[model samples]
Target chain A: MQGYIVKRILIAAFTVFTVLTVVFFVFRLGPADPVMVMLPPNATPQDAENLTKKFGLDKPLMVQYGNYLKNAFRGDFGSSFRFDEPALRVLLMRFPATLKLGLVTFILSVTVGLSIGLISAVKPDSIIDRIGRLFALAGMSLPSFWVGIMLILFFGVTLRWLPIAGRGTPLHYIMPAFCMSLYPIALITRLSRSSMLDALKSDYVVMARIKGVPEFYVILVHAFKNASIPVITVIFGIFGALMVGSAVVVEYIFSWPGIGRLVMESFFARDYPVVQVFVIVVTCMVVTLNLIVDIIYAYIDPRIRYQ
Target chain B: MHSNQDNLLELQDVTTTFFTKQGEVRAVDGVSFSVGKGEVVGLVGESGCGKSVTSLSIMRLVPQPAGKIVSGRILFKNEDLMEKTAEEMRQLRGDRISMILQDPMVAMNQLLTVGKQLGEPYKFHDKVRGSLREMCIRLLEKVKVPAPESRVDDYPFQFSGGMSQRALIAMGIANNPDLLIADEPTTALDVTIAAQVLKLMKEIQRETDASIILITHDLATVAQICTRVIVMYAGRIVETAPIKIFYKNPAHPYSVGLIRSVPVLGQPVDRLFSISGQPPSLFAMPKGCRFAPRCNKAEKKCFKHYPPETWLDENHSVACWLYPGD
Candidate 1:
């Protein structure tokens, strides 16, 4: 088990390396130049050269890449041309907000989704099942931006009960977080419901019932444990995806100060360093989350625990 | 056959059906039988003969909405099971009655440890002052599971199919249940493992005096362990007889065909004897006798009308026109 975990961590590091290399080259190959975005439109050729030299743009792509890779290892992401501060520092500042939002949404979606699924599975043709099915249908198909817009319209413009944008107060997170969580909630509900339905039909579940286990214990303890295996996989995958960043559209609509919005702003300003740094941080989050997910998988399935 | 004697369990016209999208299927149609105290009665039949469904109905573990015990009187210890509320049935099960399922692999929750699963019913039904850890280890030892102390913490996957079945047997006999139902317990195992499981079940029966309903399709197995046998064909009980009479002088044609199919040590044969034709479908049953289409001895009258169970003697009975009088 220790060997497997070490192997997984190695693979995760290699994945981040590949991603970082690809993103760096992609940024270099893009049409806009960071130096041009940094300097004024009427700046002289000498001014452009000085700025280029200052940012190491005059160096060969290989040299700059080597420097970038070396500095990335040391947590020294170069200054953000947009923020005029170190890219790593800027990201670290914004990360806590994104982490908080992500964790809250993750907890809510999983709790609510599994409950709906469990109830739906137990009484398949009941009203609860019907309503859950509809929620799942809308949750998966509808776009987050559209959902965010609708939430804003209903809760923001119509009722004026909550703030539309910014991230200081607790209420500020409601609209965007709800919008961002919609797809995962729906997917988890549908996955849990189907898997739970299948688990409930299994012989072990029937055996539990025959053992005279209470209905509540039968459904939750016996049936739900088996049902939640598949649900756990999908859920942790979603959490890992969201851990890196929230939906850009939702963050933008709510003016949420998260890494998603940060990445978008850097892309707009043609700030390659900040964009690269943002990608590295987010990808690292994803890789780490996946490692945690794999460990959790091993914990739940004994077949993997030995491996 | 034991109509006047005291019995541990009695099922009279216990009919169960499943409602599928296609139509309603009479899975267990008017099935009737009885298991006396300390009796090991074999409920033997071909697959889809409603053996498993019959066991499930008795446990009240039949899937709801789709599957229902439409009509039945399952009398256990002088109590009508059908009249009992769900709560009452819950208390009766795992306490007075328990069941072990067919597939050992899927018969247990993969996530739970064997000890936890074993202790579940014991915890609910038995009120011991301390832990059931000692009981679980002893039960495991009784079933001859190796390394009971350590293996109890292991999950179902850690145990082999045969060993898992042993744990299941331990679980079935845990609460000292009056009646234990084993549904195809050895069907998923190898022949050697199957014999061992049957032997363990016999041992458990001896130890607990728990009357067992051993559900299986293996007739030879029934003869080896069960004292009395109830033969079902296409969801109906075609014959019920003492195991010796069932083997020496089989009454029903199906029973004769079944025993004939078993390979004897020195008997030279062209091919194994087989009762040809499939069991009738649930949706479109035969006009009269359910097994008429497959019975070589079936007469014109057999296809024209149904035959009631007729007693050849006090100990043997057959549901065929050949034996019309009780």
Candidate 2:
């Protein structure tokens, strides 16, 4: 088990390094002059040259990437052009908002979605199953942004029950969390229902029933635990997806000053340092989540752990 | 041979039907059998003949959407099992009767360790709580698994197919159930391993004094182990008798054909006998005898009406018009 953990960490580190190398080159390949965008219209050519040399833009791509790696290793992400602050500092300032929203949304979605899925799976052709299927269909059919807007209109504007957006108070979390969870909830429900159905049909489950285990024991102990594998895969996949993608529409709708908004601002301002660090950080976060998922998956099923 | 033992379990006119979108499939058609204390009864049938379905129905383990036990009384020790609530049934399950399913490789949960798996029946019966380590070791020993103390902690993958089957048997008998229904328990094993498993089951039955319902397609196995044999065809019992009587003078044509089909060793090959044609689909069964189409002795009247069961003697019975005179 210790060896497995060490191996996983090493693999994750290598993956992060590969992602960093790719992101560094990919950003350089884009058709845009950072110095040109940074300078004033009447600035002299010497000023542009001086700025390029200062930021190491004048160096070869390989040389610049090498320096970035060295500095990154020492926990120095350099200063952001637009924010006028260190890249790491800027990231730290805005990340908590996104993390908070992502965590709450993930918990809520899994709980509600798994419950509905289990209910539907247990009584496949019942009214509750029909309602769950319809709800899943709606969640999939409607876009997250559209759902957010509708929720805002009904709950915020019309009923005046909650605030429209912003993350300081508890009310700020409601609309954004709902929007973030829509697609994931649908995905989870569908996956859980199918997997649970299959698990319930397994021979072990039949044996459990023959042993006189109650219906709940057959469903919960024997069936549900086995069904969780697919659900867990989807959950971790959604965790990375929700954290990265949940940023765009959710930040816009809620006015949450998270990584999504920061990255967008840096893009418009042509802040090369902030943009580069943001891509690297987001990539690392996603890769790390996937690695954690792999570990958790193995833990839940001992067969995988030993293998 | 009559031990004057109490009937430990009985199935009275049990019919399990599957209502599919295509049609209603009568998987178990009014099948009835009983097991007395410490008696071993064999349910013999080909694939899709409803032996497994009858076993499942007796346990109420039928899949919900399509499979339904339409009519019957499943009585255990004079109490109606069919009328029991889910809770009551749950209480009776591992504690009173347990089953050893076919394909032990799939029967045991692959994810859990052998110890955790064995501990489940104890937990199910509320007989043990927390750290069933010692109990698992004893169970492994009881099933004749080597290195029980260490092997208990191993996963199902670590064990060979035969070992896993023994582990499953251990789980089935953990609660010392009064009745054990083994549904083709050794079907997935090789001939040698099957023999070993059957021997272990017989040994366990003797030690525990538990009644057993052995569901299988092998007549040789029934002959070797069972006291009584119930021969099923197309979801119905075509014949039933004591093991010796059933093998010596099978009254039903299907039973006779099945016994003759077994190849005799050290004999010259002539034309290996086989029951011609396929078993009828349960959805569209013939009006009279189910095996009439394949029976060489089938008569014109056999096509018009179903044959009532005929009692040939005190211990043998046949569902055929040919035996009506008796």
Candidate 3:
């Protein structure tokens, strides 16, 4: 098991390195110069030259790449032109907010999704089951940004139960988190519902019921564990997706000051270092998520012991 | 309730049906039998002949939204089980009755350790807490599982086919129920393992003196373990007799053909005996006797109306038009 984990970490490290290299090349490919983007409009060519030399932009591409890789390993992602601070430090500060949002959304989605899935599987075709289906449909159909706006309009503007935007108090997180969680929740609900339906029909469940296990234990303990195996895979996928995409729209709309919003601000300001660090963080997050998923799979399913 | 108060289980005109897009399928139709305390009763049938459904009905676990026990009663010790509330049934199950289904590979929850899985019956029905670990180990050890102390902590995947089936048997008898229904307990296993499982079952039965409902398609398995046997075809019981009598003199043509089909050692014939034609589908059952389409001795009247069950002797009965019906 330790060997399996070490192997996964090695692969993840390689993937992070590849992502960094790609981001480096892609950002440099753009016509914007880091020095000019940072300098005032009236600054002279001499000022540009000095700034370029200062930041080592005049150095050969290979040398610069090596330095960037070395500095990235040491937790130095250069300084953000806009923030006038180390890009890694800025993102590290904002990291907790994004992590909090992702964590909240993930927990909320899993609990609600699995519950509805189980209920639907138990007495399927009931009124509540139909409502759950429609709920899933609505969740899948609406975009997160549109959903976020609608939530702001209803819960934030009309009812005033929650603040319109921003992240601080517990209330501030609800609308954006709900908006962010919508699609994945829908996916989880649909996937787990079907998975649970199949599990309820499996022989073990029948045996459990035959053993005179109470209905709750049969459904929750026996059926739910089998059903959640596939659902967990989908959950990790959703978490990875939320970390990258939905958070951007949600953070932007809510002005939550998370990595997504930071990414947008840095891109607009052509803060290359900040953007590079952001992309690299996202790449590493996904790699780490995949590794966690593998470990969890082994734990949930006994058949998956790593040699 | 009958004068034979020793009967542990009695099914009276139990008819379980399934509603589908096609039509209503009578999976178990008018099936009635009685199992005396400590008697091993074998329910023998072909595939899709409602043997499994009969076991499920006895357990009150017919799948919902499609299958339903449309009529009749299940009497355990002269008390009608059909009248019990769901909660009461829950209490009765695992306490007075437990079932081990076929296919040990899928019969156990994969994620649970053998200890927790086998410990469930005692927890739920017996409420025997605090010594669950020891209880599970004892049950496993009783079933002759090797290294019971550590094997109890292992998951289903860690056990082999034979070992898993033994674990299932242990789980089924954990509460020491009066009746244990084993549905084809050894069907999923190969010959050697199957024999071992069967032996374990008989030994357990002898030790506990619990009544058993052995549902299987294998006549040889019946001959080995059952004291009484019921032969069914297409969801209806065709014959019921003591094992020796049933094997020696099967009145129902279907029963005769089934026995003839089994190959005996050192006996060679130009061809093995077989009942011709497929078993009738539940959805499209014949108006007359269900076995008439395949029975070589089927008469003209057999095609017009269903045969009423009749007792030919003091202890043996057959469901065929040839037998005189009162």
Candidate 4:
């Protein structure tokens, strides 16, 4: 167990390092002038140079990256050019909102998707199965942005049932969470349904049925528990994907102050420090989520529990 | 013949058909047999001879999409199994007639613990989760599992193939069912373990008074453990007789060939006997007795028409013309 944990942590750390290095170099590679962007338009060249030197961008690219890593180790993400605040501070301020959105969407998608998938599998030839397949198809085919717009137009514009955008109250969260959940919900449904289908027909299930276990209990307890490994893995992995993907469109559409919107704003102004820090933070979040998913896999399946 | 007094279960003209894309295939074609109380009736046949299908037909456990008990009356204690609803059949399945399948390793669920799997039947049948812990321990002990209390919690993989078979046997007999259908229960185990399990099953059967339907392709296994043996060829019962009568005066050519093919340990021979032909396909079965294609005593009548089952004695029957003075 210790060895597995250590291996995972090292992998995560290496991934974070690779992501930081790539983002730092990629931003630096752009011809955009960080010095000019930082300084006022009326400032003298000497003042621009001073500002560049203070921020340590005057150094070579490798040296600048090394300093960034050193500061990163000590919780020192440089100040955002636009916000005039520490990059770390901006991230910490915005993370909770994104976390809330992601968590709600993740929970909703997995629960609804798994239930529908199981229903579809259990009554395979019924209308419910057809409906589940259609839902899964729509979830996969429709882009999140288009789905979000459609949802807003239908629920917010026409029906006046939900807020179009922004995340403050519970009502503000519903549309964005629904939009973000689409693909994971679809993916999880298909995966769980197929796995459940396979599990239901297995010898063990027949054995369970022969033992006089009620049909519902056989499906819910024996088949579902056995089939869960794949669906859980898919859902957890999708959480990381959803977090990154939803951050931008959801943040923009909702006008929610989140790391996703921060990245978007940084993109428009070419704020190198903000962009690099945002990339690193998102990378860390993904790596951490993947680690947690791996741990969860082992926990749900005792066969993997090491001595 | 065993009178109706001892007959616990009987199947009359049971035919199981599987519908595939091509056509319907009669897997078990009008097979009939019975098991007496406390009797071990061996269904001995090579693979695809419908031994397993016959067992599944008796338990009503055949899966859908391909398999179904198309035509038959499975009489369990004078009750027509075909008339019972699936729910009704399910109730009688584990408590009254339990099954232990071939491939013991895959037969039991890999995910569930040995104890949970063993205790599951009791919980399902008895309707009370109380006493499950004690019941599980007792079952483990009944199946001869060592450290009954501690080892019960381990997964199927934790136990050896032999041990898993024992665990499966324990689960099958947990409800103390009147009939235990063991479908090649020792096929996956090594020789010694196979012997141990067969012995354990016999011992348990004697104690519990449960009739056993032992399904196997091994004639020697039937010789060792079965009280009566049914030799199936091409989804049809070619011969059935009491153990002593079967060995002393085997009537069916198939059973004789099968017994001769088994390598006897101390017998000197130029070469071991071999049944020379493959089993006929059920889809395009031969017109006569299914074994006539391979039979040394095949006659013109044997090739043109299927033979009626001829009674050799009160206790023996063979589905071949040669037995009735052809």
Give me the TM-scores for chain A across all models, comma-separated. Answer: 0.92, 0.94, 0.92, 0.91
Error at B251, model 1, angstroms: 2.3
Per prediction, fnat is: 0.82, 0.66, 0.84, 0.57
TM-score of 4: 0.89
Candidate 3 lDDT tens digits, B1-326:
23378899999999999999899999999999999999999999999999999988988889888999999889898899889989888888878888988899899999888899998888888667668898899889999999999999999988999999999988889888899999999899999999999998999899899999999999999999999999888999999989999989998988888898999999888898888899987778999988888878889999989888898776788989888776
Which lDDT tens digits does candidate 2 get at residues B132-153? 8898899999999999999998
Location of the lowest summed lDDT over 10 successive residues in candidate 3 chain B = B1-10
DockQ of 3: 0.69
**TM-scores for every predicted model:** 0.94, 0.94, 0.91, 0.89
DockQ of each: 0.75, 0.58, 0.69, 0.56
Docking quality tier of model 1: medium
Off by over 4 Å in 2: B1-5, B126-132
lDDT of 4 by residue, B123-144 (tens): 8776455578888998899888
Top candidate on DockQ is 1
Candidate 4 lDDT, A1-307, residue by residue in tens: 7677778789989988888778777877888788887777899989988888888877888898889889888878788878889878877888888888888888899899988999889888678889889999999999888888888889999999998877778999898888888888899989999999999888888888778777888888889888988887787665786668766887787677777887888879877777778778877877888888777776666677553
Model 4's number of clashes is 1
Predicted candidate 2 versus true structure: per-residue lDDT over A4-32, tens digit per residue? 87788899899889987887788778888
Residue B222 miss distance in model 4 (angstroms): 1.1
For DockQ, candidate 1 versus 4, the one ahead is 1
Give the CA lDDT, 0 to 100, for residue B75 in model 2: 82
Relative to the true structure, candidate 3 has a C-alpha RMSD (angstroms) of 3.0
Which pairs of residues clash in candidate 3, taking residues 3 or more apart in a chain or in different chains? none
